[model samples]
Target: MQTRVLKYFLTVAELNNITQAAERLHITQPTLSRQIMELEKELGVKLFDREKRQMHLNKAGVLFQQRAMTMITVLDQTKNELLAVNDQLSGTINIGMVESAVSDFMMRAVQKFQEKYPDVRFNIFDGDGDTLRERLDQGLCDLVALIQPIEAAKYNYFPLPVQEKWGLIMRKDDPLAKRKAIMAHDLYQLPLVVGRRNIVRDDITDTLKIDLNKLDWRVIINLPENAKQLVLSGKYYHFGIYGVYQKYHDERLAFVPFSPTKTTGHLLAWRKNVQLTPAVEKFIQFVADQTTHKKI
Candidate 1:
């Protein structure tokens, strides 16, 4: 398929409106529709379900969209690489990372990488492990910083320097906050704001072996900033990475580690056997080299 046709398909897939997509593509609506119809005919599958004024991707279309995205990313990267001369890196570095203390390594690596390849830009996407992994599988990001236990065989990974400590962030004035370390038993009946990532929560639950029903789960927070604000209310506690609170420091809050000192390693991972752009490859090596001494 032509790259332009793939671009058209992606535009329609994104907007889900023929008129909007045509306008954005600077092509006539009929021409855009004809292209999509031709694409469907070529693929021998209905790509969309249309009714009245709306159009949505069918199952086949959804599958095609994933492949189309990866294809487009590869094509774009290949073009950029071929156009570059010598060691000058000029493409974007798309890195997705979960919110945690381990992000310090990602940031530091990016800083060092940029210093070497000044023209290389970074697109940082933050989410929970699942979201980030979904983006990686869809070829939206070149690399991802994930807190383990990931499927080790799924990707090639470099260990990040820090083993992030799991803990509770609570108001300093809270009686439990005075304790040096928090116990799973200490959390019973407390108003808690936990991350929405099932893996993180599952690890904690499995480690503590506590009945989740016993805790007053106030909210399931996805955004770290929102979780930070929730803890500021003094009525809620957040189960989060230890060092994140250092950046969002509050005199009223304290980050107390778990009694048994639960910690999980972080990894910077990329899809196995996928072709990486030179910029991405360089950045990955830079990260690995920078953290060489600190790797866990």
Candidate 2:
């Protein structure tokens, strides 16, 4: 089957209108229609249903769409790799990173990498570790920096020198803030403000054996800034890494490291056995070296 036909099919399937897809593809309607017809005949299946001048994908088309998307992604990635091989770090690198890593390691690494390869571009997506991992697995990001280790077999993980120390963030006047180190049980008594449950909460709670249902958990925030805001209000306490905690170390907020049981490690991950281009290789080395030197 011709790749062009698959491309035409995918465009039509996405737009659900031949005219719109053709216009978007910068091809005339007749040419696009012919390509789609040829694909249908070659595949021996009707990919779409026509009803009242609208297009709806049939069951086969739905399945084919998934495969076609993967094919296109692989083809695009191949093209990029080839371009990168020409000693031009000019292509984009999509990165997903947890909130803490964004402030701690990612910022420095990206700054240095950009300085070294000014022609290279970056697309950053910041979220919790689990969300970052999900984006990495779905091919949405070229790499991910996570605070937690990824146990998935498909991913190859590199431990950064920066080990994350969990901390309890609260108002300076809060009783827990006066303590040198906060215990997990101490957090249970306060109204806990934590990031999304799936991302950081469950892992920390599981490690500490803190029952979420039994604790005075106040809010489940998804953004790092929101967690900071809540902790600064003096009513709620947030649990996060020192990197994030340090961001709000003003007079209104105080952060104490959570007792040793709560600390987690940071790691970088990408698909196993996948060949990385020179640009990505340089970035990986740069991150490794920076983290090692900073001892973060």
Candidate 3:
């Protein structure tokens, strides 16, 4: 399918109004409608559900929307990579980050990198490690900051300075909140919210020797923010690093470090076998220089 047609589909899918989508796309309404119908015919599936004046994505449309967006992003990045081959160190670096204390380190690197290469720019995407890895695999990200238990061994990485301390997000009024650290038995009686990454979960399980399934595993979350609203209910606890611990800013929530002091470091990684843009290569070297003493 043509990229222009895909853009038309995405525009309509987002606005859910043919006239508004056509206006935003700066195209005639009839032309937009014809393009949408032809796209559906080409794929042999109805992409949208029409209800009188409004249009919404059907199941097929929803799935296609994701693929369409990915295709567009890859196209844009490929163009940028080609343009970045020139002598000028100008290109956008798509950086994926997890919500860890190490993300702070990444921002610092961004600040320094920008100061040195004013022509370059960065697009930052935040998610859990797994989500970030998926984007990196799809060539959506140029570099990603990942915390410990990184299983993507195919990618080359350098350790970031500092490590993340494991902790619990607790309601301030809870009696356990008064403790300096959370013990194993403390978790046995409490309902917990945890990350979806199995490797990290295994580390926590082996370190604490607690069976998570035996406890209340009410929900699975990719980021700490999703658990914040649940934690507000005072019925569940969130396991996260000090980044989210200090980030919540809500007076009701208290951060309690895990007893025995579990910690994990972070690494800045890039996919293997992909041609690196000049800006991305320089930024990687800059971060490596800041994080390590090794000569580049």
Top-lDDT structure, candidate number: 3
Considering TM-score, where higher is better, how would the candidates rank from best to worst? Answer: 3, 1, 2
Residue 31 lDDT in candidate 3 = 95
Better of 2 and 3 by lDDT: 3
C-alpha positional error of residue 41 in candidate 1 after TM-score superposition, expressed in Å: 3.3
RMSD of each: 3.9, 5.1, 2.0
Q: Score every model by TM-score.
A: 0.76, 0.68, 0.94
What tens-digit string does per-residue lDDT give for candidate 3 at 23-62? 9999999999999999999999999999987999999999
> How close to the true structure is residue 33 of candidate 1, measured as C-alpha lDDT?
94
TM-score of candidate 3 relative to the true fold: 0.94
Ordered list by lDDT, greatest first: 3, 1, 2
Off by over 4 Å in 3: 293-296
lDDT of 1 by residue, 203-239 (tens): 8778877678787777887767877777888888888
What lDDT score goes with residue 144 in model 3?
91
- Report the Cα lDDT for residue 60, model 1: 98
Model 2 has a clash total of: 1
Better of 2 and 3 by TM-score: 3
